[model samples]
Target: MSQPQQSTVRNRLLKALTPSDFALLQPHLELVATELRQPLIKPNEPVKQLYFPEVGFSSITTQGSGGKVEIGIIGREGLVGVIPLLLGSDRTPHDHFVQGPGEMLAISSQAFCGAVNESASLHKLLLRFTQVQYVQTAQTAFVNASYQIEVRLARWLLMCHDRLDGDELRLTHEFLSMMLGTQRTSATLAVQALEGHRFIKAQRGRVTILDREALENLADDGYGLPEAEYARLIEGA
Candidate 1:
C-alpha cells in the first residue's frame, strides 16, 4: 500500500501497527461497507474474517432463553474475532453484529492469524486489546447489575456517542431493549427519563444527545473506567 493509503486507515488497531507489521498485513486488508444490524460473527460459527471497524460500532452479545444483551462494543478502537483467533478455534461463544452503519477493513481470519503468529508486536497489541475488551465486558455487567435503568441507559448512550461521529443515533426502542436486556416498556420509560432531564431527545426510532455532560453525570462512575483503560492500553500503541 502507498504511504497515503496507510495514513488514511482509521481503525486504531491498524493505525498502531509498526510500518513492517503493517506491510505484512496490508495486501490482505479489504475495505468494505457494513450495514446496521449486520452479523459479522455468529455464535458457534467459524469466523472467516476479522473486522476492524473504521466508522461505526459492533456489539458483542450473549443470548439466552430471555434474549440477548450486549457485553461489549467494538469500533475503530478494537477488532472483532480476536477470541476465536487467539484460542486457535474457528468459532466464538458470542455473536458480533454491527450496531450502526459504517465501513470496515476486513482480513480473512487465516491471513490475520498468520500475520499475528509471525509478528510479536502485533500479537502483544492484540492481546492488550483483548484485555481492554474484557474490562469493557466486566464493566457492562457491573453497570447492568448495580445501576438504575435510567443510569444504565445514560451510560449506554455515552458509549454509542463515543463510537459514532455525531450526536444523533438511529436506534429503536426494541433495539435498546435488546441491548439492555430489558422489556421494551422499561426501555421506553428509561428513555423518557433521560428526555425529561434534557439529556437526550427520543423520537420514534432515534435518540439525539442534547447535553453530554449531564448524561455523563447521570451515568456517574458506570461509564469511565473501561474507557480510561482502553485509552491507556490502545491509544499508546
Candidate 2:
C-alpha cells in the first residue's frame, strides 16, 4: 500500500499532528474506501482499528430499549476509535457507522495505541479531540430537549454540510428520523418547514441546501459552539 502524504492528509486530527508525531503514524496508515452505512465500531465490541475520514462522516450513536440516537458526528475533522484509546480500553460504548460514502485512512488499533504511548503530542491531541466530541454530545442533548424539530433539523443539516464537500446531502427521511430520534412523520414535517422557507430543498433520498446563511440563522446557538471549539483547539496545535 502507498503511504499517506503527511502534509496532505485530510483528517484534521492527523493533520494537526506534529511532523515527528505524524511520521510515527504514516507508515501504518492505509487508505481505504468506506461504504455508506458501514459499521466501523460496534458497542461493547473490541475496536480493532481507527478510521480518519478523507471525505465522509460517521455517526456515533447510543443504543437502548428505546432504540438508537446519534450523539455525535466524525468526519475529516476527527477520528473514530479514539474513545476506546482514550479510556485505555479495547471496546467502545457506542456504535459508529459511516453516514456518507467516502475514503478513510485506516490504522490498526495496536499501531495507533503504540504511537499514542510513544508520543506525548499525539496523546494530548487525541485527548483534546475527545473533549470536542463531548461538547458535541452535550450540545445535541440540549438541542433535542429544548429546541423545536425545525430548529434541530436545521442544525443537523448545517453540521452535515460542514463536513461534506458540496451543498447536496444524500439523506432519507427515515435516516433523518433515526438521527434526530424522532418519528418519520416529524422528520417529514420538519423537512417541509425548511423547504417552505426555501432554506433547503428536499427530494428523493437527498436534501440540497438553498440558503446556508438562513439555515445558520435558524440553527442559532445550537450549531456553532462545538465547531468553534474544534477550531480553537485544533488550530492551536
Candidate 3:
C-alpha cells in the first residue's frame, strides 16, 4: 500500500483562523511526521516549538518516585506545548512523546508567540483549547484513581482509535502498561479479556478494535464523553 498523505489541508485550529490571520502564520508552520515511540520533548528541557497535531496523538507523561503515567493526550483535536506559552514555563514537567504516527504542524516558540500576539482570534482559539485540555487532564486523574484496570484500558483503546481514524493501532503492551500505570501482567490480562469479548483483537504489539460500541460500554463512565466535550467546546468557541 502507498504511504498515507502526511500534509494538512485544514487543521481544526488552523481552519478556525480567519483567512488573513492563517496567512500570517502559515509560512512558519512546518509540517513534520511523528515517529512511533519518539519523544518530542523530554522532561526538564526548554520548550522550543508548539505542535498542532494534524493526525495521531501525543502523550504528556509525568514520572516520579512511583512511575510514569500519561496525564494528557493531544491529537488533531488540540495543540501540544501550550503551557509554556500561556504560563511562561521554562522547565518541562512531563515527557511529550508520540503515541502513534501522524502529521504535525510545528512553529518555533518565537513565531508562535508572535502569531498569538498578532492575532486576537488566534489567541482566543488557543486559550479555549487550553481550557478543554485542562478538563481532560483532570478527568484522567480521576480515572487513574477510581477506575478499574479494564475500564481504563478500554478507554485508552477507544481514545487511540478515535484519533487515528481507524481501529487498527500500532502500539505495544509495554507502552500501554506505562500509559495506564499498571503492571505488565495486569495489562496483559486486560487485553486478553477484551479479546475474549470480541471487543478488540490483540497481537504481539498492536491492537485492533473489533466492536467499538461494546468497548465504549465496557469503559463505564470515565471515558468517551470527555473527548466529545473537548470537540464541542472547540467547535463552539
- Inter-residue clash pairs, candidate 1: none
TM-score of 1: 0.96
Model 2: lDDT equals 0.91
Best by lDDT: 2
Evaluate model 2: give its TM-score.
0.97
- Give lDDT tens digits, candidate 2, residues 150-200: 999999999999899989999889999989999889999999999999999
Candidate with top TM-score is 2
Where model 2 places Cα greater than 4 Å from the true spot, the runs are none
RMSD of each: 1.6, 1.1, 3.4
Q: Residue 53 in candidate 2 has what lDDT?
A: 93
lDDT of 1: 0.89
Error (Å) of candidate 3 at residue 29 is: 0.9
Q: Judged by TM-score relative to the true structure, which candidate is superior, 1 or 3?
A: 1
User: Which candidate do you rate higher for TM-score, 1 or 2?
Assistant: 2
TM-score of every candidate: 0.96, 0.97, 0.91
How far is 161's C-alpha from truth in model 2 (Å)? 0.6
